[model samples]
Target: MKGISENMYCSDCGKKVKDGADICFNCGKEIPRGINKYITAENLPEEYKPISMWGYFGYQILFAIPIIGWIILIVYAIGGAPNINVRNFARSYFCFYIIAATLLLIVYLS
Candidate 1:
């Protein structure tokens, strides 16, 4: 089996870092405990509104072709958003996609 490397980016600072590194070298941001489990709305800045919402929804509808949608998501995430609810909305949208994908796959393979 081929080993796939998981990329790490600082959750708080958005700086790229080594996967196993304990802290972000770029911004000296401490990696939060259980950072991988939840994405919060408050941390995001105020410039990423329009894209994240559309980009998050696009992920579900365009799951089979993710390249474009992912690009949009990255843009929105990096740009930031003013609304505190935006991130949570996006998070729930992706969560729904997970359930929907599982059901669809089961239906298709049955």
Candidate 2:
């Protein structure tokens, strides 16, 4: 299953967990959320100071690699990008993804 499928059942309450859920609404069990779960779009930093400008675009270009590549991408997405202090969540997320992808590619290719 590429993602939480419709057939999937909640591990906690045995009820079905909806796709992209942070918690099982039916049982209140904490489900593993994605990278975006840590912060909302509105709460992210404002500029791309620490987040490399080349990062996001780079990840998109490398996303096709198997297991390791995807794993690295997730890590990047989770680490977030550096901020100028305004808390630019989206920019941080993009930068993290980019930087992680670049590093992963470098490591894997060598």
Candidate 3:
């Protein structure tokens, strides 16, 4: 994210092009600047960055830890986590737990 603008991207390599640059540093392609259609970062609403695969894997591992993991999972699911991706994943995990518990309870009762 550093040295990259949220709005500008290299058309050839798909890397974010430097702001006001005439060429794409990533692909050495000539860039067409001053395009009127592109919206700057400031014009766009604040968005949560996408969670990387490693980040999701780490979160899942953290959530797998017993009672402490449960606490963290609950916290994240309840919007304690800043990233929407993390929060949504946590909520989905929480739902999985709920559904699992319900199934277990039904089986036990039967």
Predictions in order: lDDT = 0.57, 0.55, 0.79
Cα RMSD for predicted model 3: 10.5
Models ranked on lDDT: 3, 1, 2
Question: For residues 1-110, what per-residue lDDT tens digits would candidate 1 score against the true structure?
Answer: 42345566887777787555556889888777554333345433354344556665655565334777554444434444344355555455556657998999999999
Q: How well is each residue in 5-105 modelled by candidate 3, as lDDT tens digits?
A: 35676777889766656667888998654542344553332346677899999999999899999999999999999788899999999999999999999
lDDT for model 1, on a 0 to 1 scale? 0.57
Q: Per-candidate TM vs. native?
A: 0.33, 0.29, 0.58
Model 2 TM-score, 2 decimals: 0.29
Best by TM-score: 3
Write the candidate numbers in order of decreasing TM-score: 3, 1, 2
Candidate 1 all-Cα RMSD: 15.2
Per the 3 Å backbone cut-off, how many clashing residue pairs does candidate 2 have? 9
lDDT of 2 by residue, 33-95 (tens): 452233444434354334455754565555446666556555545554244421344345457
- Residue 40, candidate 2: alpha-carbon lDDT: 40
Model 3 TM-score? Answer: 0.58
